[model samples]
Target: MGQAWRDWGGVIGVSACALPIVVALVVALSRWRQKRGVPARVAWWRSAAEIGAVAGTLPWIWMILTPGEGPRQVHLVPLRDLAAQAAGDPGTAVAQVGGNLLVFAALGFFAPIRVAALASPLRLAVLGAAGSIVAEVTQYALDLGRVSSVDDVLVNALGAMLAGLASRRWWQDDVTRPLCTS
Candidate 1:
C-alpha cells in the first residue's frame, strides 16, 4: 500500500484538488449562459458530472499505466488468483476489488446522465469492460510490471453497472421533457 501510494500519490492529490475547481467552473459557465437567455443544451449537472468523472478516473488510469520497477506479469485465468489472494490476505483483496471497481465508476454513473444513448446498464457495462480491457492490454503490451488480468475487467464492468443502476433515476433517456424548457 505504501509502495502504491509512492507510485501514484502525486497524481491522486492533483486530481483531488482539481475536481472541485472543475465542477465550479462548469457551474459558473452554466449560470452565465442561463443569465444571457441562452439555454443550455446539456444540463449543468451533467457537465459537472462529466468533469468529475474524468477528473476522478484519470488518476487511477495513470497509476495503472505507470510501469513499476519489476517484470510484467499476466494472469489469464479469470478470478482464480483473485480468489486465492482473497483467501490469503483479506485486506489486500478488499483494496484490490474496491480499487478496480472504482476505476470506471464515475464514468458509469455520469455517462448516462450526460448522454441518452448510454442509459442502459448493458451499454454501461460493455463500455466499462471495453475501457478496462484497453487498460489491461496497454499494461501487458508495455510490460509495465503490472499484473494484467481478466478479473480486473470483470470487476470494473460490474462496478460500472452498479453505478449505472444507482443513477437510473436521473438517466437522460428516462426524462420526458427537455432539460432546458426555454
Candidate 2:
C-alpha cells in the first residue's frame, strides 16, 4: 500500500484537488441542460455521468502514459504477465490487477448513462479493450518503459464489463416500441 501510494500518489492527489472543479462542471452542465428543457433528473444524471467519466478516467490515463524505470517490454502472450505477477508478491498482484481493471472503469460506469449506444456490457468490454490497445500501443511507441501486455487488455475489459453491469440500472434505454393491442 505504501509503495502503491508512492507510485500513484501524485495523480491521486491532483485528482482529489480537482474535485471541486469537477463538481462545479457537473452542476453547471446540469443547470444548462435543465434550462434547455431536459428533465431535471435526466439532466443531473447525464451531466454528472459525463463529468465523472472524464474526471475519473484522465488521471488513470496520465499514470498509464507516464514513463517507468524498466526497459520497454512487450508481453503479447495472454495471461503471461498476469501469471508471473500472481506467482510473485500477493500485494503486487492485487495492485497490478486492480489498477489494470480500473483503467476504463469510470468510462464503463458512466458512459452508458449518457449514451444509449454504450449501454451493453459486451460493448463496454469491447470499448475497454480498444482503449487498452491504444494505451498499450502508445506506451510502446513512446518508449515509456512499460510492459505492453495482452493480459492488461483482458483485465481492463473485464473491469469495464463489470462496471457496466453495475450501472445497468441507470443506463439510458432509448428503445421505443409501438403499442401492442391484444
Candidate 3:
C-alpha cells in the first residue's frame, strides 16, 4: 500500500483535494440551474454529469501529457503496437490497454447525458478518436518522450464506445435512434 501510494501519491493527493470542491460545485451548479427554472432532477443530472466528466478525465489527460525520459516515438500503423503489447508481459499489456481505454471513459459515459448532440456510440467513438489524435500530435510536437500510436486512438475510441453503451440507459431520448438507414 505504501509503495502504491508512493508511486501514485501526486494523482491521489490532487484527486483527494479536488473531491470537496467538486461536491460543492455540483451542489452550487444544481441549485443555480434550479433557480434558472430548470427542473431539479434534470439540473442535478446535468450538473453531476458535467462535473464528473471533467473531474474524472483531467487526471488521465495530465498523466498522458507528462513528459517521460525516453526519446519520442510514433507508430502510424494501427494494431501494430497493440499486437506487440499483447505479446509482451501480461501486466504491461493490461496496464497499457486498460489505461488507454479509461482515458476518455468519463467523457463517453457523461457527455450524452449532458448533451443531446453526443448521444450515439459512433459519435462518442469519433470524439474519442479525434481527442486521442490531438493528444498524440501534441506529444510528438512537444517531444514528450512518448510513443504516439494509432493503436492508442483505436483502443481509446473503442473504450469510449463501450462506455457509451454502458451508459445508454441514461443517455438522452434520441440515443436509441438508428445509426444508418441501410
Candidate 4:
C-alpha cells in the first residue's frame, strides 16, 4: 500500500501536470476541425488526449476521496525541514512541492484557453486559487497519504498565474489561425 501510494503520487504528479495542457490543446484543435467540416486525423487524437488526462488524474481523485483505516495525524514541521530531513533529503521535498504547484498553474492557465474563459488573468488566478483550495481540502479531509501544506497552495497559484499569463500568445490572430487550421 505504501509502495502504491508512492508510485501513484509520482504518476499523479506527472498527470496532474500534463493532462490539463493536453486536454486544452485537443479541445481547441477538435473544435476548430469540426467548424471547418473536415474529418482528418483529429478525432482519434482528441479522444486519446482526453482519455490519457482522465486516466492519469483518476488515481489522485480516488486517493483524495477514500477514507483510510487509521485515525488522522497531523505533524507540524518547519518548511526547511520537511520530507528531506525526515527522509534525509529536504531538496526532494522542495522539488516535489514546486512540481505540484507548476502542475496546477499549467492547468489554470490552459484550461481557460481550452474552454474560453472570461478573458481575464485575474479570473484565471481565481480559478487556479480555487483549485488549490480544493486539493488542499481533499488532503486535509482524506488524511490518507497526502500532507496538506501552505507551501503547496502558494506554489500551485504561482503556476496558474504563470500559465495564464503565457496563454496570451494563444489569442493572437496569427498563431490561432495556423493552429486551428492544422
Name the best candidate (by TM-score).
2
Kindly list the per-residue Cα lDDT of model 4 for residues 42-132, writing each as its tens digit: 4434333344434543544454445545555444443542345347656656556556555555455444444444246777667666776
Q: Candidate 3, which segments miss by more than 4 Å at Cα? A: 1-7, 173-182
lDDT of 2 at 110: 86
Cα lDDT of candidate 3 equals: 0.85
Question: What is every candidate's alpha-carbon RMSD to the true fold?
Answer: 2.9, 4.2, 5.2, 7.1
TM per prediction: 0.84, 0.92, 0.89, 0.53
Sorting all predicted structures by lDDT, with the top scorer first, yields: 2, 3, 1, 4
The lDDT values for all models are: 0.81, 0.87, 0.85, 0.55
Native-to-model Cα distance after best TM-score fit, residue 83 in candidate 1, in Å = 1.0
Instruction: Summarize candidate 1's per-residue lDDT along 77-181 as a digit string, tens digits.
Output: 988867887898787788889989888998898888877788899999998999999999999998888888889999999988899889888884433234544
Show model 2 residue runs off by greater than 4 Å: 172-182
| Candidate 2 structure quality by residue, lDDT tens digits, 62-152 | 9999999999999989888888998999988998999988989998898887878788888999989999999999999999999889999
Candidate 4 has its poorest 10 consecutive residues by lDDT at 171-180
Select the stronger candidate by TM-score from 2 and 3: 2
lDDT of 1 at 152: 93
TM-score of 4: 0.53
Which residue pairs show backbone clashes in model 4? 84-89, 84-90, 105-159, 105-160
Pairs clashing within candidate 1: none
